[model samples]
Target: MKKKLLVFTGSPRPDSNSAILAREAARAAREAGASVEVINLSRLRLNPCRACDRCRDRGPGQCVQKDDMKKIYPRLKEAGAIILAHPVYWFTINAQTKLFLDRWYAFGGDEYQCFKNKKIGLILTYADQDVFTSGAVNALRAYQDIFNYLGAEISEMVYTTAAGPGRIKKNKPVLKEAYTLGKKLVS
Candidate 1:
């Protein structure tokens, strides 16, 4: 069976570096025979999780609020692999990304282990040349913890440092790496 990859871009700017990289990766994934779907969080109307523990009472995968996230839930559950592409802000993920992730609470609870055994990939872009020294490392670690808790395995993580919009295009190595990661996902 062909693999299905669901990619989420957390950058608000349509032309942001992170978005570019994500598009490139998605293209490569398509070329490698995987079906790909890219969702830009900036264009969606996703709200943050209220933490009301309503999911538990509703029996998992249930959110009280009906928003754009309702569209994403089914895709997420059906995907064989998931990719998160975002630009680092203040040494962490952007607000849009955080809000989307927090809403995953609806998928929590023992009954909804739908995320288990799924593969995850991360593509992060930052302004600082040394991401480890720029506090972005913590953001990467946070993602790791979240995926681990969800019973998903991280197959690849690609990080690059570029300041201006579309500057990531100048980094050939990173672009190549992103493409390679995508191709690997279907292999």
Candidate 2:
């Protein structure tokens, strides 16, 4: 709890392009003297929000579903900065990433006070040539709406077009951007 940053990598593919961006960012955050944790969503057993309204009453840690999400509740509350790195699929955020976002409803019990002023970052990868065709815009819009509603500060949103796994490693400028974002998030 109370760590500098928590990066959730939502790609199902291990070491994907989005994951590379997350790694670069995390490395820079560490160099900036920030504590960082990079969590791969694929490695975690996460369930979609059932919308049972259990968390809406008590807020924060009150969730009915017993899953890995329980482990994230306090960390999400305590992290100074949060980064969501994921690949776009079907013209929107991937399933796993969307599920994670949905579960943030649990934190709504306190009117999302846990997210107020929290620094948030996003790194999105898509297969198409640009944001539109890649459908990265869709995912970006969703994140914008979600974070804005939560009263969080979106430090940065960096997206790239990487057609295959780890292709983002070739995009040096984006990588550097993510690094800069990491430092800025903590500062």
Give, for candidate 1, the lowest lDDT window spanning 10 residues: 105-114
Residue range with the least summed lDDT across 10 consecutive positions in model 2: 1-10
In order of appearance, the predictions have TM-scores of 0.95, 0.95
Each candidate's lDDT (Cα)?
A: 0.86, 0.88
RMSD of each: 1.2, 1.5
Write the residue-wise lDDT of candidate 1 on 92-182 in tens digits: 8878898899988888776448889888889998989898876679889998899888889889888988888888888899999899878
For residues 1-187, write the lDDT of model 2, one tens digit per residue. Answer: 3247999998888659999999899998899889999999988988889988988776677799989999999998889999999999899999989888888888877788989999999999888888998889988888889888999989888888888777777888999999998888887
Candidate 1's C-alpha runs over 4 A off are none
